[model samples]
Target: MTTAWMNATIYTGEDFAEAILTEDGRIKQVGSAEDILSSSPDRVVDLNGRFVLPGFNDSHLHLRHLGKQLQSLSLSGTKSIQELIVRSRQYLKDHPDRSRVALTGSGWNQDQFSEKRFPTKEELDQISSEIPVALTRVCGHVAVVNSRALEVLGLDASTPNPPGGIVEKKHGELTGLLKETALDYLGPLYPELTSEDLRSQFQAAFSAAVELGVTSAQSNDLSGSNTQALAIWNLLLDMDQKGQIPLRLTQQLALDTFEELDAFFEEAKQPPSDHLSMGPIKLYKDGSLGARTALMQKDYADCPGERGTDALSDESIRKVLSWAQENDRGVIIHVIGDGALERVLNLYEETEDPSRHGLVHCQISTKAQLERIKEIGCYVLAQPIFFDYDLKVLVDRVGDELAATSYAFGTLMRKGVSVSLGTDCPVEGVNPLPNLYCAIARTDLEGKPDGGFHPEHAMTLSEAIRAYTAESAFQEGHADNKGKLAPGYLADFVVLQHDPFQEKPDALLRNRVVMTVIGEKIVYTHHGERSTTR
Candidate 1:
C-alpha cells in the first residue's frame, strides 16, 4: 500500500515537513506536497492544513483494568461519604445480580471529599451488610471496604498486618482501609471473568486507544492469578494474529514467581509480531501519594510519624533485580515516594546492568535523585496528568521542599534522563491532549496557581510531545523504528485540528484528534476528507 498525506504541517521532532509518503507500512519519504504529488503512486490524503505528529505512546497503563473501569460504577467525583454511599446503593439497586458477587468500584479520593478523610466501614455497610464491598481510591494503592468484605477476607483485630501493607484500624476497630499489599488479598475475592469476557474488555480498551490517537501502549496485567494472567495474554495474542487488535501492545507481565516467569519465557521464545510483543516484568516498590502509602524519606508533613509503606523490602528488590539480570529480562517497577525511589535505585546499582530496568511513577524525587536517574540511564515512565489531582495536596503531604521538586519533568529532561509520559488510565483518563496540557501548564484542570504549579519545572510543547512519543518508543525498544515521522519509521501518526506549538497550553485540552493512522491504514477518522486508491 502506497499513500501520500499532503497539505499538512508535519512535526517530525527534528524538523517540520509539508507531506509524508508511506509504502508497505513504513514512511517512504517526507518532503514538499508538490514533490510527494509528483510521485503520484496510488492514493493521496489532503489534510486541509491540519497538524500531523507521531501517534501517542502511553508508556505505562493497565489496559484490562481501564476496560473494566469503563463498565463499573465510578465514584470519581463524589463529594462526601454520603454521596459515595448513595452512588453505591443506587448502582447495587440498578444491578440486582451484583448482590451475590463482591461489589467492585474505584476512583474515590479523600482529598475531594468534604470530610477530608477515608470512608469508614459503617458508611459502606449502609449500602449492603450482606454483600462484600470494595471501593478503591483514585491512586489505586489504597481501598476502603465494608465490614462484610473484612469478614469475607477473614481479616480482624487478631489478623496481623501483612508485610509492606497496612490494614488500618483505630480504637482497636477496623476502619476498612487497606493499603499496598492488603489489596493483593482482595483480588481472589472479586468475581472472575470468563475468556470471552477478557476478550471483550481488551477490545473496548484497544478501540478507545486508537480513538485517542494512541498507537502504542505498555500495559501491566496486575489482575492477580497467574492462570488468568496467562489466559488474558493468550487472548491478546489471538487477537493480534487475527488482526483484531488496532494498536501495538508491549505487555509488562505481572509474574511474581520465578516459576511463572520461566513458563512465560518458555512460551515466548519466538520474536513478537508488529502488533503484539512481550516487554518486561512488572513489579511494585511502593504505593501512591494520594493514599499516603508511598514510602517516603521522612514523615508526611500533615501526618507526623507516618512514613508510608514500602511494598518490597530492600533484599526482595535486590533479588528481583538479580534474577532479571541473570535471565536477561527487563523489569519495570512502580516507585512513587522518594524513599522507595532511593531503595529501588540502590537495588538497580547493585544489578549487573542497571539500564535493563525501568521506573514508573517517579513522582516524588529530589535533585540528587534526578541526577542519579540520569546516571543510571533507566527509562522513567512518568504521568504528567497526575498533577491534576496530586497538585491539590502535594505540599500538605510532602512539605514545601519536596513539593517543589515533585513531577519534575523539565528537570529530568535537563539532566539527560529519558522520561516518557503515561496516564496510568483508570487513575486518569488516557487522553494525551490533557496529559500534554498538564506537562506544559503544570496546573490543575481549572488552571490554578496563576502561572503554574512550579512553572519552572514545566516542559515545553516539543519536549512534552517527545516524552509522549520518542521517549516512550525508547522504553518499548522501538526508538529507531517507531516514534518519528521520517523515512524508515512506521507510518503511525495523528492528525489534529490545530498545531500544538502554535496554541496556548489551555487550548491543548480542547484540541481534537481528527484522524489516527497506524501502519499506513486509517484506523480512526473523526472529521476528515481523503482520496484513496488501491
Candidate 2:
C-alpha cells in the first residue's frame, strides 16, 4: 500500500527535506512536493505545511507498571503526608469495591514536607486501619504501607530486610515503609490479577502511548526479579505477531541472579519482531535519590550519615558483566549518585569499549566519570521529566554544589557521550512531549526557577530531537530501524500540529499528537480526521 505524504516540510531527522513518500512501511523517496507525486499509485496526503519527524521512542519505560498504575489510585502530586492520606481516603471512598487499596503515586518530595519526613505507618493506619494501603514514593524505589497491609503479608519488625531493600523503623518498631527488597513484604496480600486484567491495563497503556506518537517503547524491567516478567513480555510478543498487540514493546529484563541471566542469554538467539524483542539486561547499582538511598560519595544535604545504599556488590557486577560481554547482550544499569556512576563506569571500563550498555538514571556524574563513560562508549538514558520532579529533591539530597551538575544532558553530549531521553514511566509521567520540552527549555514542568536548573546544561532544539529519536534508538541498538526517518527504516512517524523547532521549547510541551503511524499503518489519528489508509 503506497501512501504519499507531500506538500510538507519533513525534517528527515537526517536532512531537512521538503517532502517524502512512504510505501509498504518504508520511505519510498524524499524530495520536493512535485517529485514525490509523479509515481504515486496509492492514497496521497496534502501536508498543508506541517512537520513530519520520526515517531518518538521511549528507551526506558515500564509498560506493566504503566498499566497497573492506570488502575491503582494515584497520589503522584501529593505534597504532604496529610495530602497523601486525604487522596487515599478519597480513592477508597470512590472505589468502595477494592478491598485492599494500593495507593501508588509518584510526585511526593520527601524534602518538601513541612515535617521533612516520609509517610509513617501510623499515618496510613489512621486513614483506614481496616483496609490496607501502600503508597509509593515519586521515585518508585520505596513505599509506605499501613500496618494492615503488613499484617496481611505476615510482616512485622522482626521480618528481615531483603538484599538491596530496606524496611524503615522508628524506636525499634516497623515504620510501615519498605524500600527496594523489603517491598516484597506487601505482596500476596494484593492478589495477582489475571492475565485478562493485565491485558486490559496493557491495552490502556498502549492506547495512551500510541496517542502520544509512541509507536514503540521498552519496558525497563526493574521491579521484576525472575523470568516472570519475561513470560509476560513473550505473551505480548505473540500478541503483536497476530496483530493483536496494541503497541510494540522491547523488554529489558532486570537481572536478579546469574542463573536468570544465563537462561535469558540462552533464549536471546531469536530475531526481533515488529512487536517484541529482548532489549537489555538491567542491573541496579544503587537506590533512588527521592528515598535518600542513592549511593553517593557525600551525605545528602538534608539527610546526613547516609551516603546511599549499594544494591549490588562489585564482585556480582563483574560476574554479570563477564557473562554479558561474552554473550554480546545489552546491559542497562540504574545509577543515580556519583559513587554509583563511578562504580558502573569502572566495571564498564574493565569490560569493553563503547559497551552500549545503558545507564538508566545517570543523574549525577563527575568530569572523570563522564570522560570514562565517553571512553567506554556507554549510553545515558536520562529522564528529563526528573528535571522538574527531582530538582528540589536533588538539591536537598546532594546540596547545591553537586545538584548543579545533575541531569547534565547537553554537557555529556558535547563531551562526545551518547545521551537519550525517556520518561521512566510510572516513575515519571508517561509523556514524551513534556520531556522533549524539558530537554530544550531545561525548565521544570511548572516553569519554575525562572531560567531552569543549571540552564547551561540545556540541550538545543535539534539536539533534543536527536536525543528523543535517534539517540534513543542508538542506545537500544535499533538505530538502523527505530530512530530516523529514512529508507529501509520502519515507517513509524508522528505528524504534529506545528514545527516544534519554530516555537519556543516550552510551547512544544503543550503540543499534542495529530497522527501516529506505525509500520506505515495509521494506528492513531486525530478524531474526525480522514483516515490516511482509507
Candidate 3:
C-alpha cells in the first residue's frame, strides 16, 4: 500500500527535503506536503513537525551476543570485583538453580581493580564456590572464570595454552582469566548451551534490535573457531528464512581456520537475500584497550617495556587478505592500537586495493595512514562510544598524551575517509543515540579533560548522523539502496521527537525516537507507550 508522511523535517543525508511519498516500499516523491498528498496514498501520517531521517544501519554488531547478554547476569556497571561478586550472588539467589546454572555477563575492567589485577579464582570462589561462572569484560575479548568453572572445565595449570589465546596463571595455577581465542580454556568444564537456550537468546537479541529501531545489522563472529556461536547463528538464519527472524542481518565470516574460511569464500560468491548476506571475513589484529591487549608501536606509558601482542601473525593476515581479494569477499580487520593499525595499512598497501575491505576499529592511525586510507577510499567503521570507556583505559595505559589520540573519528572523516559509526553493541551497549552524543561531545559522560578528548577529532551532529546511517550502508556496499531518504531509496526511516542537529550537543542524548519505519512498515513507535508493527 502507498503511504505518505507529511509535515516532517526530512534529512535525505545529502540535502534538506520536506515530506515524502512511498509506494511498493520505495520513495515515489519528495516535494511539498500539499503536492505529495495530492497523489492520495492508502495511509497518511501527519508527522506533526517531527524530524525524519534514514533508518540507521549498524555496520558491526553481535546480535546473538546482545540477546544472550540480556538473559545472563549483567555485570556491565560493576566498578569493582566485590561489586561484580555481589551482583552475581544476587542473581544466583534469584534463580536458585546451581546444577544447571551458567553465569554470563560483561563489563568488568581489570585495570580499574584495586590491585590492578584480573579477578582471581579465589575471589569468584568466595562468591559462588558451586557454580560455573564466566564473566567477560566490557570488550568481550577477555573473560574471567571462577574455580568452580575451571574445575568444571577440567582446566588446570597443566592445560596448554590453545592457539591464539592465553591463560593467565599465578603460582603455577590457572588464575581463571582467558584471553583471545584461548576462551576454550574453560570449555571442557563449561556446560554446552542447549539448542533451546540458543533459540531463546536469538529471539531475545532480534527483539532487542527491532525495539531499538535497528532494521539491519552486520553481525560479527558468525563463522569462527567459536563452534557454538556459529551453530547458533545457523539456527538464527534458518529461522530468518522461515520468516521467524524478525531483523535483517549480514553475518561476518571470521577466518579462524584456513579450510573453513576457504569454504566460506566459495559460498559467499552468490549473495543471499536482504534478510541475510555474507558479511566480510573478520580478523583480529590486536586486543582491546580495556584489556591492554591492543598492540602499540611503543610501550604503554603506564607499563614501561611492555607492548601488547598481535592476535594473529603477519603472514596469516596477509594470506587471508590475499584470498579475500582473489575471491570476491571483503575483510573487516579489528585494529585498535597504533601498532595494529600500522600492520593493517601495510597489508592493505600490499593488496593494492583501497576497496578490498574495511577496518573495524581504526582507533589509532598515523597521519600517513589516514592519508593512505583516503587515497584508497576504504571504509573506517569506528565506534565513538569507546571514547569514554576506552579513553579511561587509554589514559591509564598510555598516559594523557596518547589517550587524547584514541578513536580519531573527526580526523579520518576530514581526511576524506569513508567514516562510519556503530555501538559495537553489548560491548558499548545497544543504544545508538548515545553514540551520536559521544561523536559530538568527543568526551566522556562527565565532560572530562577540558576541550574534549581530541577536540580536533570531534564530529558535528550532521556528520555523526551520516556516519551512523549513510556511511554505515556504504560500509556494507548498500549506499544506493540504503542510507539516504531520497526518492527510489528503501522506505526505511525513523521519526525523531527532536531534531538532533538542531538540539544542543549535550541534549541530543535526551532526545528519543518517536517512530521507526522499515520496509514501509512501522516497526517501532513511542507516542505515549511502546508499540510495534512487526
Q: All candidates' lDDT scores? A: 0.86, 0.77, 0.76
Q: Better model by TM-score, 1 or 3?
A: 1
Ranking by lDDT: 1, 2, 3
**Prediction RMSDs, each to the true structure:** 1.8, 2.3, 2.7
Clashing pairs in 3: 152-189, 153-189
Q: Write the per-residue lDDT of candidate 1 for residues 1-534, one digit (tens) a residue.
A: 578898889999778999999999899999888888898758888788899999999999988888887777788889999999999999998977755588889989999999999999999999989989999998888899999999998999877788878888898988999887878878755677877877788888888888999999988863365656677777887888888888888888877667667676666534268988888888888888888888899999989998888787777667767778788889988899999899888888877777778899899988788889888878789998998899888999999999888789888987788889999997899899999999999998889877998898998999999999999998888999898999999999999889988978999989988889999998998854453333
Of candidate 1, the 10-residue stretch with the lowest lDDT total is 525-534
Candidate 2 residue-wise lDDT at 269: 42
Q: Candidate 3, after superposition: displacement of residue 294 in Å?
A: 0.5
lDDT, model 1: 0.86
Alpha carbon lDDT of residue 520, candidate 2?
77
**123-166: candidate 3 lDDT, tens digit per residue:** 88877787788888878778988888887787788988777678
Going through the candidates in the order shown, the clash numbers are: 0, 6, 2
Global CA lDDT of candidate 2, please?
A: 0.77
Candidate 2 structure, TM-score to reference: 0.94
Off by over 4 Å in 2: 100-116, 221-225, 265-272, 528-534
Where does model 3 exceed 4 Å of error?
A: 96-101, 111-117, 194-196, 226-233, 265-272, 527-534
